[model samples]
Target chain A: MSIVGEIIISALLLVGAGFMLVGSLGLARLADPLQRLHGPTKATTVGIGAILMASMLYQFVGHDKISFHEFLIALFLFITAPISAHLLAKAYLHMNRTDRE
Target chain B: MISIALAVSAAAISFSVVLNLWRLLVGPTPTDRLLALDTMVINSIALIILFGMSYATFIYFEAALLFAMVAFVATISFCKYLLRGNVIE
Candidate 1:
């Protein structure tokens, strides 16, 4: 791979990893589940999205064939994350709807 | 350099998974546990794809895709149970 492509891939991997780290930190340290939910939903999506882009780009630069499957995973995650997050929130409220916070 | 980067990212992601597991184990509420489980699924998916990238294989790609689908279904069913007290009613 060329130096520029290498740089981009490395950057994506590092940044994605960093986001994942931060998101997990939030999950562990935060006091509330609702607040903690923010971390995994947004950061994981963007983080993994970046990693997927890096993978697709790496394959494009390093291999002869084009691959769209990486994007397929990203798209699936993007669509699912919000739906799961929303439903999780609803379930949480269904149990604790009387509490004021 | 690529290998080094892959190793570092893999380590970081694994640490993140460990943390997610911590939340899963010690979450005060069932909802919190489910949230952690959902997040863990995404983390594993990312790690699996990262593995695919480093190993230069296409088969892990299929596993990653299928895993996502199954995890999504599992999350929905678990949430349904939480909301309705039954999954298939």
Candidate 2:
């Protein structure tokens, strides 16, 4: 890989991982479960997205072969993350109401 | 430089996971625990992808795909049980 390509891959990976760490930090530090939901869904989505994009580039530029399968995982995560977060939030609210009664 | 970045990324993510674990154990409510679990799932996925990058192999792709599916199902089921009072009902 050229220096440019290498730098791009490294940048992507570092940014992705940094976001991942930050998301988890939010998860740990946030005051409420509902507030915590924002961390993984939003930040981790971008984090993993960046990481996947970096992987795709590394495979194509370093090995001279283009790989598209990485996109599948990214797509799946993007689609499912919101649904799960929604469900979890609803459940939290539902149970919280019951627990108080 | 790439090696250093990868190492640092991995360390950061691992520390994040540890932080998530702490939250999971200290959960004041089940929802908190569930959220922690969900966060861990995503964090692990990030870690696996990074591992794949470091090794320059695509094999981790399958594991990552399967984990995403399983995590979704697990989250939905956990929520379903709470919402409906039964997992399948």
Best candidate, lDDT? 1
Question: Candidate 1: how large is its RMSD?
Answer: 1.7
For each candidate, C-alpha RMSD in Å?
1.7, 1.1
Q: Can you give the TM-score per candidate against the true fold?
A: 0.96, 0.96
**Best-fitting candidate, scored by DockQ:** 1
What lDDT score belongs to each candidate, Candidate 1 first?
0.88, 0.87
Evaluated on CA atoms against the true complex, candidate 2 attains a DockQ of 0.81
Deviating ranges (above 4 Å) for candidate 1: A98-101
Tens digits of lDDT, candidate 2, B41-88: 888988898888788787888999899899889989988988998986
* Cα interface RMSD of each candidate: 0.8, 1.0
lDDT of 1 by residue, A1-101 (tens): 89998999999999998898888878888998789889888988898898888899889988856889989999999999999999998988888874554
Regions of model 2 farther than 4 Å from truth: none
